[model samples]
Target chain A: MSDQVTPSPGKRRIGVYVCHCGGNISDYVDVDRVIDAVKDEADVVVARDAMFTCSDVTQEEIAKDIREQGLDGLVVASCSPKLHTTTFRGVARRGGLNPYQYTQANIREQCSWAHTDDREGATGKAISLVRAAVARTRLSEPLEPLVVETTGRAVVVGGGVAGMRAAIGLADMGLGVFLVEREAELGGWVGDLPKMFPNGTDGHELARRLQDEIHRRPAINVFTRAEVVEKTGTYGNYQVTVRAGGEQIRLDVGQVIVATGFASYEPEPGEFGYGAPGVVTLADFTRMLDEAGSPLVYHGRPVKTIAYIYCVGSRNETHPYCSRYCCSAAVHASLLVTAADPGVRQYHLYRDMRTYGRHELEYIESRRRGSVYMKFADDEPPLVTSDDGSLRVTVRDLLTGGDQLAIGPDLVVLVTGMVPRDNAELTTALKLPVGLDGFFNEIHPKLRPVETVVDGVSICGACQGPKTVAESVASGLAAAAQAAAVLKRGVAELDPQVTFVHPEACTGCGQCVGACPYSAISLVERGPAKVASIDAAACKGCGGCVPSCPEDAIDLAGYTDAQIRSMIDSLLVGSET
Target chain B: MTPVPAHAGTGRGPRAPHGGGPRVLVFSTNGISDPGIDLAGSSHMHYPTEVVVISLPCTSGVKPSWILHALERGFDGVFIAADGEECAYLQDCSERSAGIVERAQELMEAHGIDGRRLRMAAICSVCAEPFTRQVRAFAGSLAGLAEVAA
Candidate 1:
């Protein structure tokens, strides 16, 4: 009890302010009484109330008071820290105090509005919460952000449009880039396509153009027939080892961008009349269309009718998610067929046409150009049966009152979807997180779309999820911009609230090794005694490994054990409940 | 003379607001459940004033001694607002947090405290209703225990 929150009277000068919140709080709790309650406490040199503690004038006044009185600890009983921890930390900094010296007490959300019916109770609770914060401030040691130097190079996995574009983007920003492709050539899945949508550029031609640009850049090194075998070290100083041509080459880099592309889904034998003479996947059909002349001949048969099936292996119980780009690709393919020969009859069997955005015009154009789209329900899917090298497709038309329709055509094209490539080896080496859909998961789908939980690692292109050519390129450049922003500054700043390993208390038990999520903790010899050592740069300050140690040897810096215990004691003294 | 720590008023008078109610200390994850608890307040959802929340970076960081300390300091119960899969730190966050709760419960049993006094449930980022409802239910159970003791 002697070492608990008893701030020595004249040693620590603290300032406490309770906000009225413009009646948001004062309507329910007595803000002035809260000030009167704690003003006479030993360490409180200044106790005040503000109409809005977050206001500009009040902020200036708090800074002025801190400077005039030489106050060390500051507490503002106002809004949640999520909203204004930075705003008040600025005041602490301007007053010549460390930013971590400031503490926020959430009275509006946690007290006043929560217990509107009981004003007396809310005030008592507010006093407890604020005093608990003040006690924590009294014990908090000033901490500086951890800064580490960074290598000025990045590694891009895969040599698809996204990877090639990311490498070009990184090199353009004056950073060296290493582009690795699994295949013998520089192009990837996108490079093998017939003609990409939204533009009539040939796949091989586009790949050649990107390859030429990459070859011209002296900073960009292209490695074909390679794979990222191992990655070690923390962010900003990673050593990535790539295996190429029976040799392993290690590259020191600051960031790793995973642009590994998706795999084309292949239908099983006899499913949707596949393995028959005329039945082929959309990918196979497109390649055949590129080789054949007008009238669309396959197996030397020029006179023909074609039927297409949508969503071959996705959007069901097994996959349970829509492959986003198939509908537009199918519609664009139908337009290409019509351009070859307008007299050839074509029918598209589908469920939910999702040609979103401007691509909706392509669906409309395909329909206007003599291709018929028949909608089908989920339960009543189209069935394909072959009769002597010819195909018959039957479906219940959803748009036309569930009417059953049957059509015999010479060609049956199955519009297969994209599936995530099984990157089991790479996943283990980099600790990449995979979603339920089997695609690599981002931190946030919208805000931090390219960044992974692993620091300095970014996922781009179809490997993350299904994306069109344009979207893949967009994410590629975005990952490059993020990597550039991290490495170009030549330094990385991490939170100082990471865990601290007390050597005297540690017994080298190795309990915290398995507990650390970031693999930041390791057992090392300390004066012939084994002890846990933590890499502060790799730690995310989650304090996840603190409780796993049996000896209580490790603790978080900002929210230490002594500080937490003192906080609870301050709120519970004189009570035996 | 050293400054005396400001303590909560403990008048033995007629059940004061802070004196009678079962005081529960909550360990909430800063990234996930803290914002949800705050949303519960912003939505004007009501819970007992006896509920106090202390935000930690993650629930896995909770030590069993912290729970025992709260109980020994006269807290009626301890609630852990877990982060579940929403924890950006670890993929196995739920399992690690459950391990902590188990150890805390064992400590409670050793100290002659009922294991039922401590509770844990996953509260996500926007789960305002769940946050209020669970805390209210926990308060009722703690109050019933008090009645049984009396």
Candidate 2:
């Protein structure tokens, strides 16, 4: 395999390889028929079928053909490009041809698998797809991938459990970390909790342990009362501006991790008699339990009876999502209260119980301790009426077939859910998508859970969605690993298909500059008129600016206007042979 | 399984000297719609083979001249698979591509080509079933138009 190829002007030597995919494609569509149909297509130097073209041995064979057949262009009729596009491109590169000169046709997904019942039609479509690739290949030119330098530092937004854990993970990977916390304290909401569910671990102690770990790391830079005001540049080299302690500081980092934890749902005043005496939120109750020693006392009075109202502001018309962790938290809180005062009786008025995972043990314990649990319908909520320094809570228990149960207790704790933090400023600055639920939306919920659509930026913890402490920590580690992967190579290879400006054709009207989402285009003076110049590193190859350019000056490298037009012509109109 | 359409020939169609099926050109965005098309194939969802795909980086990158050129060169219908908000390239790609399509439709009317022959849809990377359904519907509409023209 050599990297040198001399092509005769106006002539394209193309090789076509059809993969059988081990009968994944062959059983449905006739592979040899496709090869035979496209073999005599104009400029097709060779056509063949393989059991599995993606195999290492077959790739080597294709490379061997590239050298011996003098094929200037190649096409692989196989699986989706998402699967093995880079694989075949590597083969093309080894064959001494420019990787960009190769085109991949989806014969498996778009033809063979799709029209399995119609083999003849599928084969015909495969031939046409290959023909389209060949036509496009004739117009493709060899291009090199753009290599961009990377910074070894990572900027982590929010100093919650996720941020702290991510910072530690990055530091462990030998990368410098800038951990930014909006509040003066490093620990987020986790620092305020009295006791965590399942394991009776002190939330503050857990947060402090993480904070101590971060403090001990030499590579970690802690910034309290800080916020990332602005962020610019691409994946490998990002300039972030942090406003901390009344001064602005700039940091250049390779990646960014968003761990801005969620905000606890705050119930409105008079909501379920929330502002009344003896009526406290679950968060307030947790702090009260922490402050008041072994025997829980509210206002110097020993609390003997307590009623916990579940789903205060969640799973309603206003907030449609279940705060996932609230049910388990409620159970844990009931158990804590039971442990504090063995004589105290607890009644929990709730919706559907969702004590999932290991938290089920705590739920069982709460039930074993004789804490009364009642289910209430969504439409008919429990009514809390205050009369003569005592609370009267009447709920139609769905479990007992609409039997109205009334409980009068000394104290009422509203079990509130987690709400998304108001990250409007940060969201605008980062240009990240916020879902209709007001949480940061990951690119894909399952596949790329921690990764945002933006390159080099990751979202985890409560910011992405409501997550438990353990899940938050796991997401933090995942984000840290993602960031480390970006900086691990010390250099990033951007897509070679980024947009470029034709200086001669550029009118310098600045339309492309405004149209560019990444600010990759800028106007520069050329002779008398200014022509737009593209910063290839900053350009994400979105081609948004291409249509904005009135003079047709801007075009992406791989999907050039001519190449795309040729492909369209090939599909709609046959090749002008 | 539905019977395969008669116009699966290698030659360009509808107006091809050897008349057969309606030739529909599908311009799919590489990042989103192209993968969706692949998923459609992987899912074994069938649409007409007359619909040939031309993968572009984004539908915003498509020039109106290319659509007009395809129409002039014996193509029947053109489908632009625009990536909505999920576009990796630009935030306002849907609106921008819609503007391009609208302009192309106006140009098609001026060129004596039926503006209805041009269709634009926002197909995400995961919308394989929707893509096949859209293509099948578009192909059906084009086939009806071809019968009327004949």
lDDT of each: 0.85, 0.82
Residue pairs whose backbone atoms clash in candidate 2:
A109-B41, A542-B89
* lDDT (Cα, tens digit) per residue for candidate 1, span A1-577: 0111223376688888889999999999888777867776668788888899899999998898789878898999998888899899999999877889889999999999998888888888888888788888888888898888999999999899999999999999999999989989987877777776766678888889999999999999989999999999888999999999899999999999999989888999998989998899988887887787887888887846889899999898877888879989888888888888898888999988899998898888888898898999888789999887768899999878889999998889899889999898888788787766788878766658899878889999999989988899999999999999999999987778889899999999998998885789999999988999999888878888899889989999979998999888777643121
Listed per candidate, the RMSD to the true structure in angstroms reads 5.7, 5.5
TM-scores for chain B, in order? 0.87, 0.86
Q: Looking at candidate 2, what is the lDDT of residue A333?
A: 86
Mind giving the per-residue lDDT tens digits that candidate 2 earns over A90-155? 999999999999999888887778877876666666766777788878888888877888999999
Best model number under DockQ: 1
CAPRI tier of model 1: acceptable
Candidate 2: misplaced stretches above 4 Å?
A1-10, A232-235, A267-323, A338-419, A433-437, A441-454, A573-577, B1-40, B48-83, B87-101, B108-125, B132-134, B137-150
